[model samples]
Target: MRAAKSAYPLTWRIMDALEAFAAFVWPARFGRAIPWLMLAPALLLVGLLVLGLWLIGDASLRTLDTSTFLMSETYTLANYRRAFTESLFAVVAWRSLAGSLMVTAATLILAFPYAYVMVRTSSPVIRKLLLIALFLPFFIGQVVRAYGWLIILGNQGMVNEALSLVGIAPIRLLYNYWAVLFGLVQYMLPFAVLMLAPALTAIPEELEAAAGSLGADWLRTFRHVVLPLARPGLVGAGLVVLTLSLTDFAMPAILGGGSQDFIANAIYDQFFRTSDQGLGSTLALLLVATGSLLVGLVFTLFGAGTLAMGRARQ
Candidate 1:
């Protein structure tokens, strides 16, 4: 009649040992350093990021010599110049940017209602169902979900079969600009709902009731009170969705069928397909800059909002 052992006894023992070892190494006077010690992992990650940036920047200045199939030793701005001047790059950049904006807007629009209903519903069953609907897709990997869309939207797939039942010919659905955007909006919807749910919860239901009591209709109350208060959440969700959509590689690659290209796909082509490290490095660095600039721009306009956990403005 022995008690069951801990599920991860070895891991627990190792952790305890590490704690003891850490305590042993520290001097009594260094007790005050515990706070700083907590930041070691973050500092290490930052150091690695800086190192990576330095490497990519160095590679970007070196052009690939097609003649020798090697990167040039001498640093030059040829890669940067080409990136700025190229029409292909411009097209890909524009597509990614525009798609990202559209996806963010559409996802937020769809997510707001979902989040509102989830937050406001009184019944536990409804709340659970909504949560399942919101989170189930997250468990499915992005690439897998993209493939699922392929199955549903394929010319000979379910939609086509349904169309055939009604005497309609099978139409092309996948591998188009709208298809890509549609997939992106679907992919980003869950993220938007997760972001917005908390913000909706933070708003007092009584205020909404009070608005209704004061002769304001549902539309007016939503427009003035709910909308204004939810601004932070919307901005935060929009920023997340925009950045993710802009940099997505799989959706554009798989769904576009090599026709539509995003900046990320372009970067992948440069690095892997073309075997041009210089060009790839240039694109990677520019992508980082673009994403940073966008985030900075959002912060400047919206004051960081819920992305900063409602404490940014405070």
Candidate 2:
């Protein structure tokens, strides 16, 4: 066995030695100890996340004393109570929820055809162009893109400039609920397409051709065959888009221009503007919980996570 190992390439020998060291350090009873060892960095990151969550939870339970402008020594649920009882918080929460849903729906709708065209096109030029368009926005930062929208949609900007030529009045496009949603949809489209592309790629063109030969039209083929096969991607993309839109700060902050506040914006205001760390922590913790819940719900509806898509039987 030692002679056989020596005959192998140096890289393979090194890997074998490393695997043996791992099996020795971590007992074989642990099973696949090298893989577990490889995950140490990720596990440490998760540990740090849990510690931060604990700190946030502890802060969430404390109440601020307005008199001293400090948190109460004793923990209480007053911040949570206020979070639930406040009308403004409710409004912001509802707006975020509704806006995220709309963003997810619109993003998926727009992304599907783009992804489909990119994946199914026989023309290499068409595929490359589609890919370039999809990836171009990714190179631009989200904040920059949001600001670009501001430039385009501003009253005195190019949009209105063009509108003026067409005999249309300068309209108030920025600083509204719709503006925020539009920004979110734009920000999320690339992500949706990237996620959908893999699933769509997994679907063979032969399957689509088979459907067509069986007397199924385009729409019917998409509805019965393509849509069902792409469930994992849709679920994954929707969850990502929804949670990101829900927790977004930049789009609402930049585009909404202080009128439309998402949950993250509200948390920011609490932390910075109001100097209410306790309330801010409460909102932060609640946002985490909400995002986790949404992820869980999506995972439950779908089979598994994006990475776990083809490994269900395993």
Task: Estimate the lDDT of model 2.
Answer: 0.90
Give per-residue CA lDDT, model 2, range 33-151, as digits (tens).
67878999999999999999999899899887888988888989999999999999999989998899999999999999999999998999999999999899989999999999989
Which candidate wins on TM-score? 1
Task: Enumerate residue pairs that collide in model 1.
Answer: none
- What lDDT score is found at residue 112 in candidate 2? 92
Question: Once superposed on the true structure, which residue ranges of model 1 sit more than 4 Å away at CA?
Answer: 1-24
Task: Give the range of the ten consecutive residues with the poorest summed lDDT in model 1.
Answer: 1-10
Tell me, what's the RMSD of every candidate? 6.0, 3.9
